[model samples]
Target: MTSARRWASVAAMLFALLLAATVIPDGQVFACTPTRVWDGDGPIWCREGMHVRLAGIAAREMDGSCRPGQPCPEASALAARDALVNLLGGAQGRTSTGHILVDGPTMRCLSTGNARGNRTGAWCAAPSFGDLSCAMIRTGTVLRWDRYAHGRCRSR
Candidate 1:
């Protein structure tokens, strides 16, 4: 890997370790309370104004399509979406894009970088669920996306 990418990966790992250990002061972590779920693997809208895509995983698109190179779990799109909503606190409504509005439990995340569109790629952990990506994978709703995982999912 390029030196810059290597350093970035190292940085993300350190940050993730810090977050998982909870060694830093509470407010020091980038905490987000989810306000919406776009799918099983997220673009989880956070009340904190961060649009977070759960790093290290992929689920079906809202219309049940999986990207050509992504890991596509056997679960249907709605099933995966609902699983995420349940992980969060459940949906309050739906947006025009069919994303679910939620009042989910707060999460602390380590930002890896930018994801597709304007979303931030992050490995997030909710209080009740521990690691969100791992939880999603356990539910059989999402697949472990190794390309972007950077070993985060395995660590959890």
Candidate 2:
């Protein structure tokens, strides 16, 4: 084969390898169990699978208007709570043991794992009221929740 063609082939192989590594690598993989299911905003929940898009949500939160001290507005919190409840309907009361892709500032809720309801109503941060810019996630979609802790949910 011509030298130029060989180099092109090698480059293509390397790119393919890189892509595979990003998707799945030799490491721990957790299967998420979505006891509850919601079609509203926030991270999507699945019946059984791990979450993978934590970074993307975190990035959006950082870039959004919500600041560190300021929790999500009331409306946002209610919406999230409603969505969560809708998902949790008829399921066990205890919060499911699984990693959730959440915004860094909103990480407090995930960390607490409180099933009492919305952040303000419970112990987590409250959602922004009347503000639709709240962190929104696709419901029911599953991804790798924790990447570094060997199938364990990462703490914020």
Candidate 3:
């Protein structure tokens, strides 16, 4: 009887640990796979078409004009889209699946990149590139979300 009771106690502890593992979330990487990407606002069609705002950045639509006082050529938004496609290695293959790691409004990730620093700033990263939002900022395709970014981004 004593041996049987000890075995049961061990089993209960194991079960509790398993339950905790399932309930606790991964805090570091909010990851996903996307099938389509939107031109404006840098959202993607992923996790079954969830609206995923690209954590800490914003972009113009493919047909929208550049921001006022910004000297840019016509259809700059289209160029931005193409730049994104190229950056993601042709969009369909790279952005389509298994490359996007999102932790923000779309994924309900409570603790994503700089999230500790700024509550609203979640982040998305790929296997190769470190941070997608920062990359776009560096390439002049997008700007940091001003409230969270402070003055982190500058023009190319």
- Model 2 Cα RMSD, 1 decimal: 17.4
Regions of model 3 farther than 4 Å from truth? 1-29, 47-49, 65-75, 93-121, 150-156
In candidate 1, what residue range of length 10 has the lowest lDDT sum? 19-28
Q: Estimate each model's TM-score.
A: 0.77, 0.23, 0.50
Per-residue lDDT of candidate 1, residues 13-96 (tens digit): 997655433322212358888988888888888877677888889999887888998898899989998999998878899989
Task: Sort every candidate by lDDT, greatest first.
Answer: 1, 3, 2
Best by lDDT: 1
Off by over 4 Å in 1: 1-29
List lDDT for all candidates, in order. Answer: 0.81, 0.31, 0.49
Model 2 stretches with alpha carbons more than 4 Å out: 1-33, 36-40, 52-79, 87-91, 96-156
Against the true structure, candidate 3 has what lDDT? Answer: 0.49
Report the lDDT tens digits of candidate 2 across residue range 66-142.
43532333234334434444433323443454323232212222222221222111111223311111223333222
The Cα error of candidate 1 at residue 123, in Å, is 0.5
Q: Per-residue lDDT tens digits of candidate 3, residues 45-141? A: 4453333455555666555755563334333665556555555555444344334333222232322332221122335566555566676666776
